[model samples]
Target: MTRDHSKTFYFGSRFFPLPQRQAVWAVYAACRVGDDIVDEPGGGPVVLSDWWARVQSALTGRVAFSQAGPHPVDLALGWAAGQFPIPVSAFQELYLGLRMDLEGQVYRDMDDLELYCRRVAGVVGFMIAPICGYSGGDRTLEYALRLGQAMQLTNILRDVGEDLARGRLYLPESLLNEYGVTPAMLEAAEVTPEYCALMRHLTALARTWYAEGRAGIPQLQGSGRLAVTAAARAYEGILDALERNGYDNFRRRASVSGTRKLLMLPQAWWEMKLG
Candidate 1:
């Protein structure tokens, strides 16, 4: 699922030991399906409720390795929970984020958007960190959450044009107004000076999150440190790609090429081990 759904994630997860990698894949599958519920066309409350029930059952130790029922994602999730101290609250928080989507709630400002990002993406870090092993306790966890938020923000920036076309806008209205970028300008896909400035502001904030996130990597144990380091560098490369395109997110999606990702691995390893 990771390979098929997300190449960037696959690239990072490949570095993990087989067991941890499989478990991470399970968590990713669970989260990915829930997100699909919100993003897929014709998804409604009924389908979401069924999905949520399976998650609860899986996390509570219900196992179904057969082809009978409970879904493949739930089975993998059940397996992962048995192997690790996987947090139930993380998925509960993710469910809340999906509910917000179902309700069509508007993000009032950066704080609101950050909360949304935490629910959907930050909790993912929470799920993955314990499996990776960390020594600094909550401080490290907080850094992981911030890292996830940075990636989420990166996704937001990359998907702005796509989201707007779907009649959805994740850009906080406050920032838009502050930058003198009107909704009309966004709707028209205009890459005006004001729009570029707004993008630059967000890019800077994402970079700060990335810096803080990297600080926690040295605190992680084993291959997990390198896994996260490579992932962070690869994801951060999207911000660079976006800048290279002159912040014209409307015309194209930002991505780091495979060659750049391969080049990042050794550097990520050296930085994590020595720096």
Candidate 2:
């Protein structure tokens, strides 16, 4: 089941030095493939079914999973898992999360959203944390989980209009009900004061989660703390951009440009070391 890492993922792995970089690239490549299966268009039920079955079999040691799917990412992940101490449970959780996406399940509330985030994003953190030499302490896992939640929350906020267009709503119904903003209204791209207020409220919550996530960086091993800091700060910057725009995700997608991300690296370094 061994395979070369995904090209883009390999390049991205250059941030780390030596063997750690190789290990991370393999994991990223696998995740990238799993992501493609769920995110890419034109994947039919049969294709997804086969992919899911292979993922399970590969993880369970029932079959050899090399680069045989629509993409080589999963094969790469299998190889990487075999070569390292990556958490298989986390990878399984990630696959299950993608399966949910394939089924087009929508979030009903924060609890549902948390479940989805835990499977899809939280598990990725868990998988990476162990690779980064973070022990499975409550504080470390808690921060990783919150970081994942924050990332998911930011994604949800950024993609609200797009998700609504595709008949998905991530904003908790209870909050929407409390605000008296209906799904139809959100679908119509209504940027009313109520909607704006709701978005701001949501962003505030995401910021809190990001703060909690950052608290556990000091506990990371090797250069992982720096890498995670860069990634987290870059993501947080996206949320900041959303906030600066008065919580307007409808007019344009919020992003932190490469140049800004470059600037963030130094800041992340400072936060990881001096701060």
Candidate 3:
């Protein structure tokens, strides 16, 4: 599933030992399933509600489907939750975040956008921290949250055009107003100076979070540290790609190449060894 949906993450996961890699795959797959439910054509409130119900059941150890038994995602996640200290409430927050998408939610400012990121992506970091062997406290969790936010911000910037085509805008309204950018401008796929400036601002914000996220890597133990670090570098590389394209995210999706991803592994290993 990771290979099909997210090659960058799949590549990063290879740094982990077998058991940790499998656990990350399960967690990632479960989240991917939830995301697909909203992104899929013909999906709506009924479908999302049903998915939430199934997720709740799965988290409680109940079978989500009678005929099919538990969903494979649910089964994998269920096993992962048992092995790690993943909280049920974190998944609940994730569902709420997905529900926001279904409701056509818009952000008023960075705070509102950050809240959404935290629910949808930050909680994912929290869920995986235990498996990575980080058992510190709020400080450690803060790193995970920052990493998740950085990645989500990168995703938002990369998918601006695609999201606008779907009639959804992840960009905050205030930022748009400040930059004199309008919904019509984005919807029309305009790549004006204003749009570039707006994207540049967002890209800068993402880099800050990425730095903070990377700072927390030293806190992690075992080979998982290398995996997480490599994952961070890979995701951050998307920002570099965006800059290289002159912030023309509407017309060009930014991504790190496979060769670059492979190169990050040795650097990640060096960082892990040093720490």
lDDT of 1 by residue, 51-74 (tens): 888888898897544467568888
lDDT of 2 by residue, 109-213 (tens): 779888887887777677677767775487898888888778778788888767766566668777898778886677677788898888878888889988988
Model 2, CA-based lDDT = 0.71
Clashing residue pairs for model 2: none
Best by TM-score: 1
Backbone clashes in model 3, listed as residue pairs? none
What is the number of backbone collisions in each predicted candidate, taken in the order shown?
A: 0, 0, 0
Ranking by lDDT: 1, 3, 2
Kindly list the per-residue Cα lDDT of model 3 for residues 55-145, writing each as its tens digit.
7766676747668566788888777777777777878899899999989897999998999888888888887788888746889889888
Q: What is the lDDT of candidate 3?
A: 0.85
Worst 10 residues of 3 by lDDT: 57-66
* lDDT, model 1, position 275: 51
Per-prediction TM-score to the true structure, in the order listed: 0.96, 0.85, 0.95
Q: Candidate 3 regions off by >4 Å?
A: none
Candidate number of the best lDDT: 1
* Candidate 1 ranges beyond 4 A from true positions: 63-68
